[model samples]
Target: MTVRISAPSGPFRDAGIEALREGLTRRGLLGCGAGAAGAVLLGAAGDARSQDAVQPHALAEFFQGHQVAGAALSPSGERVAVLLNIGEGGARRMAVDLIEAADPSGPRRRVPVGDFDVETLAWANEQRVMMRLVIPVTAGGNTPTGRGIANRTYELQSRRVVSMDLETGETALMFGDERVRMRESLNLGHIVDYLPDDPDHVLMAAREFSGLMALHRVNVNTGRADLVERGSQLTLDWSTINGVPVMRRDISTRGSVINIFVRPDGEGRWRRAWRQPTAQVALADFIWIGAAERAGHALVAARIEDEDVLAVRELNLDTLEYGPPMASRAGLDVSASLVDARGRYMAAAFYAPRLEYDFVDSDLGAHHRAMNGFFGNECNVVLANADAAHNRFIIRASGPRDAGSWYLYDKAARHFEYLGARTLLDTRRLAPAEAVQVATRDGASIEAYVTAPPGGAPGPVIALVHGGPESRDVLGWDRQAQVLAAQGWWVVQPQFRGSGGYGLAFASQGWKRWGDRMQEDVEDALAQIIRDRGLDAARVGIMGTSYGGYAALMGAVRRPDLYKAAISICGLGDLGDALAYERRDDESADGFVYDYWTSRIGDPRTDGDAIAAASPRLRAAEIACPVLLVHGVDDPIVQVHQSRGMNDALQAAGKPVEYVEVPGAGHADWEDDVEKDLMERYVALFSRAFA
Candidate 1:
């Protein structure tokens, strides 16, 4: 059963930023704490309130309401650990609350986890929880060496993992040791499995001295680790089943190759199961949905030869073959699978317009359908966590307008009790995002999302390109788009050719076409939106972060007449400089970053002319409109130098440009104050350009 809510009426009421802040305070959205007070104080100090006194909503409100942070369910299903951002401004900090599952509104206890920011959390057992920490690192002239797993060239200062004993209120670092000299190192092994049978130990993938990742059996309580499986020299990634490492991947210039190894009877010599390329591996790929009761067989999500979408199937490990489909969707990819405590595939989820689930287990499906009916599907529902018995679980529902809420589902009583919302916001005021398709000049259909102001009438549009030209935009409550809409600007997010989530054919088209076809797709979206919605052609502007930022600058250089103004946040300027930096930082001569970039973005060493032509810094003189450059001083991914170089080049050309350098901000870490300031600057700059 699926329920859909009506699209919001006209844009939200044009209340001033002050009124928005006051409303948040009156509604207790901003807690009564020093951190909250600091945030308010910081906002008061800003000129945002003075710049646009009659503007509806404060930028701070949007930022505050959008952050629910993280949540996890206990193995016993008795308690839920929720991580929320409390306090405001620089004083704001992340706090974890242990709430009772039965009585969510009842008094809860705060877990003292210390100063570091918690990135993610999971249950080690009913009495223990594991947490990954995001520690701040100072920016200097330090160049990271070697490509880390996943072709990551820029390394964070520190990423540590630790375990907390809820019973004793004690926590210990999981990776700190005398043997390992953790200097500028990406420490804290990645958790593979909790090993439910052995609560004291968890399977982790830790980086060894050989620059290869090896599997280890880590003791959560003692921080002692024993090597379980050693990685080969070419091992790029690995997967395990029932706590046993069975598959390893080697990524090469050609493509990914998988090696499947099996151990019979849980002991003796490990023998080869099978080997295949990514295309063949996709045929019978094993998904780590759960620990199967049957040793050599597990639930898998795979794509058949003729199918465009993935299907849920039972995979035979011994023979590397797939059985009949358990659940298959026509056009949508199978997103995830739900397994019961007994290791049985109970449900499968797929996303068509929004997320929809099918029950493979009749009993569990019926119960979930009933729960959905009771909950009322105004928002998409997700099963966050469940206990072994499948009798109790945590359900999170969220939509494009709604921030989201958590609920506890009791299977025995067939009851769903309200927990708490991540934030309290007036949904009526938020604009609804509509999925759209635009035909490019080359006749390729590009998937895009457009969020218009209250009325259907078009106005000044902001071409908000998404970062990760590799990542695609989906339907959700986008805070940035909402904030822009509240200020009366239409936001168009285009999923250019190279973006993921559509299909291999669609994504593969983006490779090595960064500035050429990729930029064309973005421009085509803007032109199509103008024609379709009758938007003001002269008032269109382009802005983005990272790759999106790169696109913004490139658009201004390549098609200055199309965009009225441009903004680039942490964007790359020179392709040559970026590739050179990667080559210098990477210890491996033929590393993944060097090879991947060479294929996807063109090699600076060999394809120097093409790279130079696409570089925004080199073509700065061609930009005719005003440009806003914003970058974090401590950004590791695309260094601060990128923005500085572009700013210098523009200044040398006597072009209209403004630069803002955010202190102590990394690639992904933006302070509340910094974001608020940027929002205000955007409004001021764009308003002037449009006027």
Candidate 2:
């Protein structure tokens, strides 16, 4: 029940406040309510820096110093707004920073929003930015309970969306009365974009009020919304093509059919223009650059692949004719994007066995030796980061052992210029990490990233599985991954069967095969890692949140010989129960949502026996390791009872199990110190367990 949370250092706090205030001012915000904002920032900074600053350990270095998150680039690429983390005393607080794109090395100044932490930051204009803040809630508030959907006097910390001007330090409340989507809950998922047709209008793309995902139009200046599109029979995947909005909706519960529709001029009525025949195993990629310079029409670059071959094609929106499939490679890979409006620019990331991007410009390539940071002489100039333009111009560069550094190029200048580097932890200060690809006993290829302790002499290792078993890991700046490495645990993140980023076949490999191939992927990954690298097989443990949490329990029970300790945070133990609690019978809520789950996992009714066999609760007796379970009492995604019931069953079975439940908390949060508490507790527990 009691958890010890870690805070940032004293120096971090002083710098945070100074940085936050300067950031706010530079972004054109006058000031937050001095009393409330100051108190919250001070409190958060104290929490983050409670422990005295000592030797710069990797974990300490990762979260201790000046850090930035939630970064958005202005449309003109002239300004950048970033979220800054600063510590006061021992607590950590969130503040905003605005930097001129020309001189992004340091912010002109910081804004001091003492009471609010910026969750999602966007550059509305070069002079104005949009920021959404977390509203705090008071505890021990009286409630008036009632039957007819009682209007409970909820103690909500009112959050308001504001547009702040950088030049004059002017702040205007934008969407004050509009209800925000819940923080962590998959709230009728929506994508908000500034309307191209009307400067004051914004498009709110999301599921309808009935809960099926769709697109809606909202007047940004006036708090008004009109339903523009209905939810798809399947899921609507939103994308922007050439400054135009295009939605790809998978029409089958099993993810079979896909329809692509485009909204003319980014705000005009959306109509079906083209359709990609949805095959069971085809992975597709689409990117739209701005209107073509010569043609003055939308240009969409797309690529589709099946288990056998990968094909790339260009679609001319005006003519509606498909370009000949250029590079028909054999592999589940291809990502394309336009560099800019010019028809000559193109950038594509292709993965067959390895990962790299192909940058091309027809005229530039034919005449130039080095075109826009890309050395035409050699393909070995591995593409690290690309700008959002159609050509995919290189914006940053790094290698296997190097941390990425940003670079800017002015085409008129025809030369690459150096920009200040954005780094989380100093890679040179940290030990080297190895990449491992293991094949499951079932003959499936599984990929993972492994970082050993600094001294090379192997000690304990932690298997860090990812949530969204549907999502996969790519080489990038992952904070948690770096934190685990700093903890001296060889952090192992396995791309299990159901994980995306892989081809469709590999991703769908987990459909209806949960706890089978999925579980086996973790086991196989660890086994190969132990064999190839000298990991202390006996000292290995497991930890994850959500779906990852479920795997921790399943691994402990299924292979007691491999894991000695396990930690599960908000993981589901019973799929049947989880589905029942989260899903509503209302078709408006989502007709295909339940069907999608049933397809990925067996139906609890017809496949009751399989469901039971795959569930962790059914195999609790096989668990041999000590376990730690953490849950939020009000988690909407995976009900809190999943962990509660498992704990009770473990105690009844005479197993060593401990549970820590936080009140007034949901699934998980990145905006509050409560989240840091949850993570720090798990680390302490794992360290103790290993000891």
What C-alpha RMSD separates each model from the true structure? 9.5, 11.2
lDDT of each: 0.68, 0.55
Q: Give the TM-score of candidate 2.
A: 0.66
Candidate 2 lDDT over residue span 1-691, tens digit each: 1111111233333443453433221221111111111111323212223222322254444444333434555555556555656656535466566666555444456765554645566655456666665566643445556644434443445454556665555665443343554332233333355543354545555554355666665544444566665656465655554324554444544333355665545565556654432322233444443344434245554544334333445555544565655544443445444343122345555542223545455543321224211211111223332234422223433322224333344333333333333344433334344467788896766778776544444667788888766655554445565566657677787888887555567667888777788888887888788777787887889988888889999888888887888999888888777656434531323444566677777787788788787788778888998889988887755678899988987888888898988776777543335555656776777777778
Summarize candidate 1's per-residue lDDT along 1-691 as a digit string, tens digits.
Answer: 3211111122321222233333222231211111111211212322223223333455567766323456777877777887766656534466667877776657877766655667778888777788888786654454566764343333245787788876667887775663453553566567877777788888887777776777788888977788887766555545666666665545433333445555433445555544443323322333445434566776667665665556787666666676777787664457677764334567887655455678855777665554443322324667777787787877776655556666667777555555556664544345556778899998888778888764445689999998766555666667778888787788999989877545546666988787789999999998898899898888989999888899999999989888889999999999889888766655443464566566768876677898899899999999999999999998877899999999999999999999999876877478655787798898888989999
Report, for all candidates in order, the number of backbone clashes. 9, 51
Candidate whose lDDT is highest: 1
**RMSD in angstroms, candidate 1?**
9.5
Distance from true location, Cα of 375 in model 2, Å: 16
- The local distance difference test score of model 1 is 0.68
Clashing residue pairs, backbone N/CA/C < 3 A, model 1: 10-454, 11-454, 35-87, 35-88, 36-87, 36-88, 39-88, 39-89, 146-587
Error at 331, model 2, angstroms:
4.4
Candidate 2 at residue 88, lDDT?
A: 67
